[model samples]
Target: METITNRTLNLHEAWFWHEEEDRLRCRLCAHNCLIAPDRSGICRVRKNIDGKLYSLNYGRLIAAHLDPIEKKPFNHFLPGTQSFSIATPGCNLACDWCQNWQISQADEVGSLTRIPEVDPKKVVQAALEFNAASIAYTYTEPVVFYEFARDTALLAREAGLKNIFVTNGLITPEANADLVTWLDAANVDIKAFDQDVYRKYMHGSLEPVLETCKALKAAGIWLEITTLLVPGVNDDPLQLQNLAQFIANDLGTDTPWHISRYYPQYKFDSPPTSLKGIEKAEHLARMAGLRYVYPGNTASSTQTVCPSCGKLLVDRDGYRTVLNELDDGRCPRCNTEIAGNWA
Candidate 1:
């Protein structure tokens, strides 16, 4: 095993793992990777160098921006607020259609060795400086950078900033045990329901993602779901039906589901999902007793309507909120309480 000659490499000792005889078993995520010496996990961010697992990308920010909470595509969670978004290199899931694959698949973009390191304190300071209501660990999977996310989240929470996880939701229960302590809300990208399809396309199982969603809900975190309906992959009628039912029955009917439009990216060449197909999926989800469903990346209006009186409560234009007709997070006209964490 090649030893890590560079001691300056951001080798923050990772949490949630133990050593075996030959390799270190990383319990950070569902993969539970047994990483050999000088090797990394499926994410390539957690490396087992000289017999210990270290988070290589800790506090290394690849992207940071002040974005609208709507851009996180979280229609239900603080709709009109700005979120301080940050992301490190690496992701556990290798979805072929990831738009941020250049950073998510950090190895593909370039060596992160040239990238400068950052500190969680600076992230919180910048979020406060920008007057962002929430700090989002996004772009790449936050679970891969769990240490950094948690560190920043703790500081952000203390500074009166909400913490949001825009994740694939494949984190292990051991890792998720800490989410509730700091995480205020999450938007889990439920790629697909078919286990075989998930394995072949994303190199992940479906059950773990589903379990993470349940755990987040049980922990009382505001949760939303997104599924980019890829034609010939996840847009099957039966699969969409099961997905809708799962959201309604398990995650609660008020859980906002984003039926997104798929565009070709990375290695996959599947044609973009049609607008009609997206509308159909939205219809199925609403029919399954889901109170809020929105079609994304299209011309569809992301306006929120009260489930009781059908009065429009919020109107959004792309990533900006044009109007919000909610009185203390309730419908102004109908007085129906909207399920969200506006406070």
Candidate 2:
């Protein structure tokens, strides 16, 4: 993909804005940062300039790759297809355990020297040329680069390509309303079920993230939930049970829950999640009436079986997929309908 040189042309006016004296209140995410002139939001990308909120990271591509849709861990959406993954620097949330903190925490000073800028038009063209089924706004939070993702998504949609987000689920309802028009699927990281953990470790609130999940599902977006299991942090049995129950009751049992193993990163010094702990969390999720619970970030089976008949439908290992008993997304043996976009 070709990189752009002109920074002025890349500056995009943000979506949600409100004037507060000389400052502009950014309502794009739950933070609702009230930024002063020449100041940026908590995300360090959306800046207030001349009473207008502008996304500084717009069309700036810090990372781009062709990844398996399964790596996004959307076990139910476009199973084995390749997705054109792209991300810009900056994240709204400041998670202590951020694995991609190198890019997610990069600010104006670091970004200018480190990252390359790409045009939205070029992003769409690259996706089409790569023959990717979807374009994923990932690695860093997509909420910070909403304008760029939205513009690219519009063109990608026009070219018959799908859009996906691997996000932190901190997006506001107003932003999500506009996003759902082009977004096809998403894998949102729940982080933790405890409110205290969110406030102290993530520098955000839990309610907004939960609300985002509910809103996305209600908006007809194919939603999947991922929870990175960090040992002695969010691996409590009660917390795992509650998280699973919430997903089963609110998001439906058909919702795929990926319990991922968390490796120590950034400011977090906790030990890596054990395979035993992952298995335990997966077991709890299944016991809580979740139909498609998966253990990720480790060697494990990524198969989709019939909830009713227990027939293996899709057998997967890494990016390799084999359809065993699924006949048009239905169990061939029991004729039970499986919940997914199998076509």
Give the winner by lDDT.
1
Tens-place lDDT per residue, model 2, 232-297, is 778999998999998999899999999999988999987888899998998999899999988889
Candidate 2 off by > 4 Å: 1-10, 113-116
**Model 1 per-residue lDDT tens digits across residues 1-343:** 2244338575789999999998999998999999988788999888887787888888788899999999887888877889999999999999989889889997722556667888899999999999999999999999999999999999998999999999999999988987778898999999998999899999999999999999999999999999989999998999999999999999999999998898899998878889899989999998899998988899756888999999988888887889888899999887889999765
Clashes of each: 0, 0
Report the lDDT of model 2 for residue 57: 86
Q: Residue 81 in model 1: shift from native, Å?
A: 1.2
Report clash pairs, candidate 2.
none
The local distance difference test score of each candidate is: 0.89, 0.87
lDDT of 2: 0.87
Which residue runs of candidate 1 sit more than 4 Å off their true CA positions?
Answer: 1-6, 108-110
